[model samples]
Every structure is written in structure tokens, then in C-alpha cells.
Target: MTTRRNFLKGVGASGIAFCSCGMLDAARAQGAAPRSTPVMVKGKRIKTVDVHAHCLFHESLNLLGTEEAAKVLPPTKGVPEHFIVIEQRLKEMDAMGIDMEILSINPFWYNRERDLAAQIVKVNNEKLAELCAANPSRFGAFASLTLQVPDLAVQQLEDAVKKQGLRGAAIGASVMGQDFSDPKFHPVWAKAEELGAVLFIHPQSTPQLAQRFKGNGWLSNTIGNPLDTTIALQHLIFEGTLDRFPKLKVIAAHGGGFLPSYAARGDHACFVSPQNCNAEIQLKKKPSEYLNQLYFDAMVFTPEGLRHLAAQVGASQLMLGTDHPIPWEQHPVDHVFATDTLSDEQMAAILGGNAARLFGLKEV
Candidate 1:
């Protein structure tokens, strides 16, 4: 079987630039030495899965051609000897005690024309399937969808999961400026529900908040990403999308944004000012109660934060996640282990059990 290391070696030979030279160069500038192979923890090996991991769609970029690819992808100053070197990725995974990573590429073609978006989705899903096939032991993927065209998206989801063997669909919190709560997206949600596919909601930069997030702090990604997720989840809750698709398996990145943290406020708002909420959309449960039906990743970066998320949503709804390749949460397993709030069973679930069950993996 072709392993992740072998597949990435092929990717490197094909000249696909997965990591930007600037990022690697910056690491070298900091005098970072080559990472050594990681030591396994004593006793039984815990199967840890990282639900939030990313990679470039090299095949899709090639299909887009030079100019369009440049428009879609970030520019790099120099060609590094390797990009997403599989051996290196494995070493890091070992170091962090992550047994597997579910890869995804947040579609950047949402604003493109329907035909262009479809093409991008096709190539992306195909490439993702190929990668997962090459390394079934260590990798799985969420399919790309063209949410702008809901009908096409529904069909694409079916093809990716049924034919290509992807686990689910990875979607931005919103398509272009359109929120997922829009009625037109109900078809896509229904399809996902029917397929029992996990819908991973990873937010894009909130362009609407660009003005407030400007200058020095990288707030476009820092504050803007999580803020966008918060808004998206709120819309799903308040606008009745969640109520409509009650069985939808949605996984919210960054600990379900800020909603899980301040969910009581939503309940209070609904109680104090019924007139403020949509009277037409009556929910069966309180807004906060709906949180139990949703899932979150342990990427909050603090023990207290993860504990709060677990307390609100329950550990059963929380899973392991590291926004890998971006250098966040480098010690995800250790982070979960260090959190005092979780019991041994809760820690086991967050580390890998929940993810294994959700993704239908039998390895654990």
C-alpha cells in the first residue's frame, strides 16, 4: 500500500508547493533545528485523530492553469526542496501523538462562477479521494462542495461520499456573503443529513469585519475567522436551519466558535424578548439546548476553554482537532491530557474515541 510518506514524495516530485517558502524560511531564520522522530508514550497507544487539518489541492491548481491558479493560491518566494513532505508530516504527527488527520481544503472558489466552482470542486474532491486512498491508515478527507449552487452541491456531496469515499463535506461558514441559513441551502443540508455525512464548518476570513480587524494583529484570521463562525452558528440557530435539519451532523471548528461559551445568553434573549426572535420559527428546545446536538473540536488552546466547551456541550460532543500546518496546537494530545476538568473517559473520547465513532473508523 502507498503510505502518506510515499504519496507526499510523489507530490514533491510533481513540484506541488504545499508549504510556502516564506513559512519554511521563517522557521530557519528562528534557528529551528530539524525535528526528531517522536517517542511514543509509555504503555497502550491511544489512537488520536485530528479532525481539523489542511492541505493544498495541487491537482486542482494545475487544472486551473497558471494565471487562475495564481489568483486562487497564495504566492511563494522560492521553491522549497519539499512541500508537505509526508515523512515530515508523519514525524510531527508522531511527536504530537496524532494517529490520523482528516484533511480538507477550504474552498476558495465560492465567489467564482458556477461552472468554475463546479470544476474546482470536481478536481478537488478527486484529488482528496486519491490522497486518502493512498494512505487510508493515516488520512481521510472531507469533500469540497460548491455551495453557491445548491443543487450542484447536493449532487457533488453524493459523488464525493458514495463514489470517492470521502467522509463528509467541508464547507465555509458562509458562501461568498450568503449565510448557510438561507433557504436555498436547505437542499444541501438535507442531502448531508440523508447521507449521514459530517458537515465541517470552517470559517473564512470575515470580510465584513475587515475594517474593525485591521492593522498589526493578523485579526483578519485571528478574530475574523472565529467571529465569522460565531455568526454562522447563530444564524443556523436563530434562523431555524438546525431545527429543520435536526439530524445534520455539523462539526464546528474552534470549539463551536463563541456560542458554546455564551450559549446561556441566547436562551436569555429568547426568554426576555420573544418579540426580537423570529416568531415564525418556533424551536422545540432552547437555543442553548441545541448545543448538545452539535459537535466541537478541542482547538480552544487552553484547558479552561476546553473545559468550558466540554461543560456546555458535553465531552461526547467534543473531538480532537489541531489546525495543523498552521502551527497551532502543536501539542494537542498533551493539551487534552493536561486539562484537569476531563475524566479519563472524557479525555479518551476527545483524544480519539469520538472522532473514530463519528468517522466510522474501526481502528480504535
Candidate 2:
């Protein structure tokens, strides 16, 4: 019954400040928004496990073995060249103090053409496998899925994980305007939960809202992305997707897009009207209990927000996510260490310990 507009009203200016003040200060201090060199963490330096870094591949050089495939992809943001190699990525990771990066392509580049999307996922997975083969310890992959075809997605997921040895899967907040919580996606969620796989849900800018802000270009990526995440989470919670697939290990990016801050309102609304939802799953606990079950990334970009997210989700469920290749957000490790509220152990967990546990990353 609660609309998206009313939900966003709760996460106003204070919420934005809570999530982004520290990085804003760092950028403001620099005069120009400059990238900071990754600092060495004192005491026992946490092995940084960045869950949201990205990469581009030579689609021409892919198994498809045609230059046209590369041409289909719109140009990536950070890496301008046609081919972004693994070693160059390593240098950037080193600069950012990221010991390991979970690589996946941004979903915006996806063409809804199902066959092409399938080919793209195959090529991307191959590229990732090649990288991990070269530098096994330094990288893990969040395999792309051709969600346009759920059965194909399941097949690719099996290949990516069982055959290619990738860590898990990465998905967009929505597929073709349909939310992940839609009944059509039950098979996808069931497969992911069955594998005990980590599903890293990333936000792509909303397609529908793009026309609304045609002149103000910033609205799509800046506002629409978080909005997309917020909408997706709302659908998952209110529609009872989380209740049905309780075992799904969902890792929501952008600190769950202000979901923790708005937990009270969501639970209250759900309590007042149960028939509004689709799935019949009920819980003795509040909606906050469901949030605690879901994992979040430490890309919220401020000490206060990080403290709040840690308090909300618990340190064990918080992993590092750098919106890498997107220069706007703060670097993951720096943001985690900057938080005074997190003790040494908590900081370590956010940086890498939690990720290690989640992905079963062997400690170095």
C-alpha cells in the first residue's frame, strides 16, 4: 500500500549527510574531486575484499570471436580504451588498497536482446575465469546472468560457479522493469539459494525515469540508482520475497539504499495491512529482522553512515563494496577505516573478514 515517493521522503537531507559527509569533506578538502591514494591500515591490516569493483573485456577477443560484439557495448565510464586488461586492473586495485576485487560488468550496458545478452554473459564469464586463472588469490568474480531468460541464467550460473569457479552471481536491481521479487523470478532465487550462492544486487539507473529528467542528466545515475535499489528492496520486503526465500544470501549495494533508516515505517505499514502483499509468509519479528538477515556493502561513504549500517545490519553482514570505475563514491577501505565507531575487529570484518566468510575466501 505504501508508495515509493512516501518511502523516499523519510531519507531526506539528514540521511544523505549521514551517508556521504566524510567523502564530501575529503573531496571538498581537495578542491577538485580527486581520487585518494589507498592508505595502509594500522595494526592488523585487513585484507581488503572489494565486492563491487568492475572491469571491461575485449568482446572481440571473446569466445564469440567477433569484433562486433565489442561494438555493441556502450563505452564504459573510467576505462576509455577498447580493452581493459587484468594487470591494469590490479594496479588500480593496489592503488586503492584492495587486496581482492569481485569483478562484474555494469548491467546498464545490457541490450534486452536475449541471445546477445547470453553471449555477453558467456564472454564476460570467460574473461573473468581468465583473470582469476592468472591471479587466483587477487581476484574473485560475481558472474553476470542473462536474466532475460531465467532458465538460461540458471544454466550460466551453474557454468560460472561449478565449471568456471567464480564466487557467485551479480544481478541488476530489476530485470526489464520487473522487480527481482516478482513471482516470475522465484526459480532464479530458488536456484541461487539452493547453491548457497551470494547474490550481489547492484543498481542500474532507472530506465522509466530517464525521460522525466531529460534536461537534468544527473538525475538518472545520481538519484535514479539509489531509487532503483530502494524500490527493489521495497518489492522484496513488502511482496514477501524475502519471507518465501529466507535462505537467499542477498548482498545489497549502496548500503541497502537507505533501507535501514526506513525500517520502522516499512514494518508498521506491513503490520497494519497484511493482505496487500502477495506471498503469505508471515513473521513473528519485525521488518528490521529481515534486514538483519540481508547483507550490505560498506560503500555508504561516511563514518556516521557506516556506524549506522554496522549497527543495523551487524558487522558480520557488512562487506566492502567500491563502486569502482565510478569515481563519485569514496574508496571502500578508506571509508571503513575512517569510521571511528567500528572497533578494530569490526573494521576488519567490513573490509575483508565478512567477505571471506561469505565467499569462503581462504585467508592469506
Candidate 3:
């Protein structure tokens, strides 16, 4: 009963529908296809590892109230305000193309009051352990400690590592106005070395310097933090701490705090004249040798800087770092990618490979 034109129209519609279905089927087949993954930059391939990233909890402040937190460091509201949750951090990591992030919290590194410090340590470490528990592959923790109590610090280090499966311990550059190299910390260092732990030394605003530079506006982080690190590193190197514990993995955050750039002076001073340097430790090799042995994060904020870091310390020693949730959200991997000199292999090493080896992560 239908006209020839109607029949032709129906046929045409059916053909169009058939083609749509066929296209979808083709797409589904393609989507299901397994292809070789090539980590290429401009047609070259490489792997990457992000060794330094910070993850904090909103509940931390609740554990340490405003007054208590301020007494410890600087007070900030903690209850409802989560700085950056692990889930969001993981999502951000995906967007940033970071293969892995070595996580630590440097906020409560040095608090003299034993009880408060211990409490904060418990809260942070438990959170870190839980986070790592929830996502084993995606997270590794650097356990917090109450460094004011060296014995307690050692205890926490053992518990955090053996019990909680932590990778290392994060300590402040200076603990209670005293450098970490002081003999008081020998037990802590000995334990760390015994465990083959990587001690991540982060800088905090010195209280004395805070009072001195109150009006100059350079007190908080600008000059204070780097200065703290520089002094801490010098003490560690010159005071014979590194010599005492040769196997200890002491990771100086912030590009070794001007040590790499100014290493020649120390070497020249140590070699050219003995008394010029006051370090008690007798040195066999040049100071630069120790520098080479120590690992540095690529948070220099530029490709040129990263290239120089690689040149100073071989690409194998360079690790990716993104001090995220800070004012600068720079991704160190991106800087490495922008660099023209690094081959794919070198890039891979700097990005994530070296860190994997350092943290004992299985091959990704």
C-alpha cells in the first residue's frame, strides 16, 4: 500500500541507522584495542617520578587546636578546613601527569613542648599511615616525629617504619634553635641510618630570626627558610655528622640550600687551608663528593635551572618535586619536559625513576 517514494525513504532511513550503528561498533572495537604506551616527548620516550609532594588533613587542626598549633608553630584553623585532601591530590596528580608523589608533612617538624609535639606527631603519622593504607601504590609516607625528644623520635621512627610501613622520616632543618647536627641528635641519626631511612630535612622559620627581622618583612620564609637550610646543611657537613653516619640518607630539601652552587668555596677552603673551615669531621674526599652523593629535588622552577641541576648532579640523582598547595604550583616534571638537553632516558630518571629506586617502589 505504500508508494515507491515512501519505500525508498524508509530504506534510506534504515541505511543511515545501520551506518550509525556500524560507526559506534567500530569505535567500541577501537576503544577496546590495547596499544603500546610510549612516554614520548617530541617523539622521544621517557619515564618520570615525583619525589616530593605534601598531603595534609583537615582534622589535623582539631587534633591540635588553634592556641596549641600556634604555640607549636603558627596557628591555623584545622577543623573544617582541609588544606588538600588525598583524593583531590590524586586527581591533581593525574592532571599534572605525575607518576608518583613522595608525600610528607613538614608543618610540625619542631615543637619543644614534648606532650603537644607528641600528640601532633601521633595525629599526623596516623593520618599518613591511613592514607597510604587506602591507596598503597599512589601514596608513600614520610613519618612525622617529635624531634625534641630524640629517644621518642627513634621510637616513632621504628614504629612508623616497621609497623606502619613508612618509607622515611621528615625532620625540620633546626630543632628548638639547635641544628640537627648537634650531638643531642646522634641517637636519632643512628636509628635512621640503622633503618636505612631517608631523612627529609625541611626548613622552618627560626624564632630568633623572627624577632630580629620582624619589621624588615623578610622574617617568615623569604630569607629565613633558606638561611635555616644553609646553616643546617653546613652544620651537618662540617660538624662530622655525615662522617659519623656515612650510610645515612640525609635529603636536604630546596636544592641542598645553596650548597651545590657554593660547594667550590667549601672544597677550596677545606683543601687550601684546614682552619678556614670549622667542621670537626675529618674529610677524606672533597666536599663536592658528598654533595654528589646526596639527592636533590628538581623544584628549581625553570628548565634552565633543572638543566644546571642535572649538570651539577648527574640526571640520575635529580628527582621531580612539586611543592604543591603552596603559592607556586610548579610541576618539576613539566620543567624537565621543557628542557631541550635531556634525552628521554635522562628525563625518565629525573622525573620518577630515581625516586622509585630511592623509595623502593616496584617498577611502574
Candidate number with greatest TM-score: 1
lDDT of 3 by residue, 1-364 (tens): 2222332344334431111111234434644211112233333333445556665654665567767655443333231213556665665565455645667788564643777778778888888888888888777879988888889999999999989988889878887788888899999999998998888877886667777767765556656766677788777777777888888886667666667777777767766786776666677566667777778777777667777877876887777776553423343444565676777677767766777788888756
Evaluate all candidate structures by whole-model CA lDDT and list the values in order: 0.78, 0.72, 0.67
Residue-wise C-alpha lDDT for candidate 1, range 1-32, written one tens digit per residue: 22223323443344322222224455456542
TM-scores of the candidates in the order shown: 0.85, 0.82, 0.80
Encode model 2's per-residue lDDT on 1-364: one tens digit a residue. 1122331243242231112222446555754222222322333445678888776676623534456545545444555522556666666666566778888776633445777677778888898898888888888888889887888889888888899999889899998688887787888888888888899888887888888756755777667777888888878876678888888988888888868877778767755786775455665467677888888888777778988888887988898887666554545555665676777777767778888888998744
Residue 38 of candidate 1: its Cα lDDT? 24
| Poorest lDDT segment (10 consecutive residues) of candidate 1 | 32-41
Stretches of candidate 3 exceeding 4 Å from the true structure: 1-47, 70-82, 107-109, 211-219, 270-280
In Å, residue 164's CA in model 3 sits off its true spot by 0.2
TM-score quality measure for candidate 1: 0.85
lDDT of 3 at 155: 96
Candidate 3 lDDT trough over 10 residues, lowest sum = 15-24
Q: Identify the superior model by TM-score, candidate 1 or candidate 2.
A: 1
Candidate 1: list runs displaced more than 4 Å: 1-44, 63-68, 71-83
Better of 2 and 3 by TM-score: 2
How does model 3 fare in lDDT? 0.67
